[model samples]
Target chain A: MKEATTSKIAWGWLALAAVFLVYPLVFQSAFFRDIGVLLLLAAISASAWNIVGGYAGQVSVGHGMFFGVGAYVPLMVFTHLGWPPLLGVPIAIVVVLVLSVIVGMPTFRLQGHYFSMATLAVAELIRLLVGTWDFAGAAIGLSGPAIPRGWWDLTFTSELPYYYIFLGVLATLLLVTWQVQRSRFGYYMRAVKAGERAAKSLGVPVRRTKLFALMLSAAFTSIAGSLYAIKTGFVDPESGFGILVSVQMLIIAALGGAGTLIGPLIGAIILIPLQTATNTWFGGGGSGLTYILYGGIIVLLARFEPGGLVELWNTYAPRRWRSGSHAP
Target chain B: MLLEAKNVAKHFGEFRAVADANLTVAEGDVIGLIGPNGAGKSTFFNCLAGDTEPTAGTILFDGQDVTNASTETHARLGIGRTFQVPATFEDMTILENVMVGAFMRHPGRADARAHAEKIIEMTGLREHAHLRARSLGTPGRKRLEIARVLATGPRLMLLDEALAGLTPGELQQAITLVRRIHETGVTLVIVEHIMEVIMTLTARVLVFNQGHVIASGKPQDVVKDPLVIEAYLGHGHGKRARKRGPAA
Candidate 1:
């Protein structure tokens, strides 16, 4: 049974990769390409958030701390030392890994609402500190150095290249999330989330599992940040460290389904297009309209479909063709 | 000895919850621990199981000091325990809950599932194995809890009120299940309020009162002790004594 499920998942992943690789070629629209890039980035970031938020049941409101660091670190290194963005990307990931531990040590002690508040405060502190710092360009932010219009620097001249790059990152993140979900660590996290006392009684290391989730989540979000900086060629304290980034990640994860493997990906696919459409239609009122849409969806889903779209699909869809078949 | 606790004490704030509690169990031993509501039976079990740290004394498991190990560490060291109120992963199926424990001993999922299946059959949970654990009735949930702990492959088993909230038939079945568990060479330390269960299943009994061990010996001899009779059986035994004119 386990082997059958694994093979099914492998086939599902293969199908998804094929679609990702061929989508831009067949669609061939600049608007769709831009939307695709944003959706891919959102999916990657939300999937990263899912490790701690969805699996561990530790809602974080400050993932922007890791994301911003991921963006700023690479830009800082590349602009000051003339380092390649590729080299700087891994460095950003490592930095966020360390930062995750730092944040986790202090805030993991606070559960539920307190933990959420602590994360928000930490992100706010980072933003304030960056705004006052000299090297990080204070409130103004930094722009990328000129590259000879190539893929090496991650600074592409067209939307198609950025689209592929973000898609690749999204794919890597999906694979990572899948592997973590099957690993012992993932089981430990789920056990902890289910009930701390029961998990402890069963001999699960609660603190260690939570810290590991935070580290993995931070690392993944940081990589997304690095991509964001490269694609936009700009980073500032506000855009990089805003609360909306955190909220958007949570919304995407929740809108799809928390704890399910592909929920965040599906969430981004649905929400990002809706958000893009709203922004195009309403202009300056787009953000407000998007929030209302998100709120309405959440209310309706919470009232009528508490388990979210994944639950809905599982209820109605054919059993043999569903992704993430391990669920019982 | 499979498990031994020497002078284990636990204090919460200024109150001594468990004071100088001691017990010893060898392989295949089913020891019952009976006490009043506030007599610290749960605290003693918690301290022994490593769910809560003891303020003082030592716990020797399989002849090694494991006084302050974490619960997970204790589990890995071959100690499995169930809670008083049936703690299970509610969202997971009964088989999956057992498999989680089995996975601790066997890393391969297929092997773990096989082990869990065998335990499910033993516990009479085979029919309900695929059902969500929360969907089980009280007796069934208790059985699932026991099965889950048993799947961990523990040499020493600690059961906290595993027989609570069961019908008379269910209680009899649970006693039989405990006997069967002991037959597998696992040492058992059970905390139960049901005197019949203690009398039937336990070879030895430890009676607790006001956070102290009042008596320990063969279940038949110890339950008849004058001090245990006075502290636990209360005035009902006194009325019987009066009616019998002190020595018959």
Candidate 2:
């Protein structure tokens, strides 16, 4: 049975890989590849958010702080020092680690919706602060390298390279998430999510586990932000630290299945295309629709099925496949 | 002694949940705490299990002081416990529920899974290993509580009314399961509402009345203590106590 499961998983991954491999070649359009890149980026960010919100149940709505810094630092560094924007990725990760600790310490100390509220508050605070900071380009924001100085500069006219790059990053993030799912820490994360008191009784270090999860999540979210800047060649306080920026990751993760491995990816698959389509059809006016769509799904899912699409998939999928998506 | 709680009192603001609790548990000895409703049996149990810190007291586990230690620290120091409400990870399967505890010692997923499987089998929950914990009723969840605690490889285990709502047959099975676990050399401290369980399972009994150890001795003698009768069993409970058979 174990061998069969293993083989099935391998096949699943190969199939997933095949889709990514074939998409660009078949579509052969910049628009499609841009959508692909955006979808993967959203998936990466959502997956990172899942480490804290989904797997560990921290439910942070302020991940835009990590993402904003990630997007901002690289571009801001380039604008200030004329250095390669990619160099700021590591700096962004370190900054996110410190920020996560600062955020996690106080919020994790108090259980329940406090973490979510604190995250939302922090993200907005950062946005407001960034809106005034002249060094980091203030509300106007910063731009990436004006022109590619070298191959390392990562500036590209084609969306294809960004698509592959994002796919690689998303794959890496998924791999890490899978490791967490199967590891001892992953088990602890679920235990912590179940109930802090029960988790404590079961020998799970609840507070510490949450802190670590937030840090891990923050780091990846920062990386995703950096990637966004690298691709877009620009960053503004509104784009970098916007509430919608933070909320999108949460919405996608919740829509798919908050804690499941492929939940964010599935959510990205469904939500991103719809998002791109509406934005294209409506031009700049699609932002309001996105909010309405997100709010509607959140309310409906919260009331009807907080377990999200993954739970539905688990219950409705073939008997053999039901065991694959373990919901927690 | 494997465990000791000296003058432990839990006060929530001005109201004292447990006024004073002193208990010592020797290694390999099984003990029971029985009390009338609101006599603070569960509260004292929580104090002993490190679920709640006492307002004033010291707790020694395996000769080390751990009065203010967190619940995880207690577990790491070879102590494990079950909640009165039968706490189980709702979204997890029975096997995964046990595996979470097994991870305390096993650390590796495969090892934890193996240990959890063995625990599930021992607890007679093998058939339900893959079923979500939320699907379980009270008795099943109580059994899961035991399975999860047992998976932690504890030297001492505390059970809080684990058999409270079980049917007669389920109670018998649960008693047998606890006996089987006792035979494995883990010391046990249980809070129980059932007299039959106390008489059959515990080596000694501590009778609580209004947050105090009003009476304590072998189950047969302790039940007859006048203070225990007046406080717990009410006025004329001695005759009924006498009718019950000796400890098993």
Clashes of each: 1, 0
Model 2 agreement with the true structure over A1-328: per-residue lDDT tens digits = 5467668878988898899977998998888988888999999999999999999998998999999999998887788888899889999999999999999999898999999999999999999999999998888988887689998889999988888999999889999999988898898998899888998988898999999999999999999999999999999998999999999999999999999888998899999999888889998867699998899989988898888898887777776776532432
Candidate 2's error at A307, in angstroms?
1.2
Candidate 1 residue lDDT tens string, A1-328: 4467679877876897888788888878888888888989999999999999988988899999999998898889877887766677899888888888887887776555777888899999999999989898889998886764455777766789888878877877877787777666777787878787777767677888889998999999998888898888889997788888888898899878888778898899899998999999989956589668877887887788765688688667776655432243
Cα deviation at A167, candidate 1, in Å, is 2.1
Question: Superposing all C-alpha atoms, what RMSD in Å does each candidate have to the true structure?
Answer: 3.0, 2.6
Residues B1-248 of candidate 2: C-alpha lDDT, one tens digit per residue? 88988998988898888877899999999999998999988889888888888999899998999999988999998899998887799998888899999999998888999999999999999877878898889999999999999999999999999999999999999999999999999999989989999999998999887778888889988876766777765766655555563434
Lowest summed lDDT over 10 consecutive residues: which window, candidate 2 chain A? Answer: A319-328
Shift in Å, residue A67, candidate 1: 0.8
Model 2 CAPRI rating: medium
Question: Which residue ranges in model 1 land beyond 4 Å of their true spot?
Answer: A1-19, A109-114, A146-149, A293-306, A315-328, B232-248
Best by DockQ: 2
What TM-score does each model's chain B reach against the true chain B? 0.94, 0.93
What pairs collide in candidate 1? A203-B72
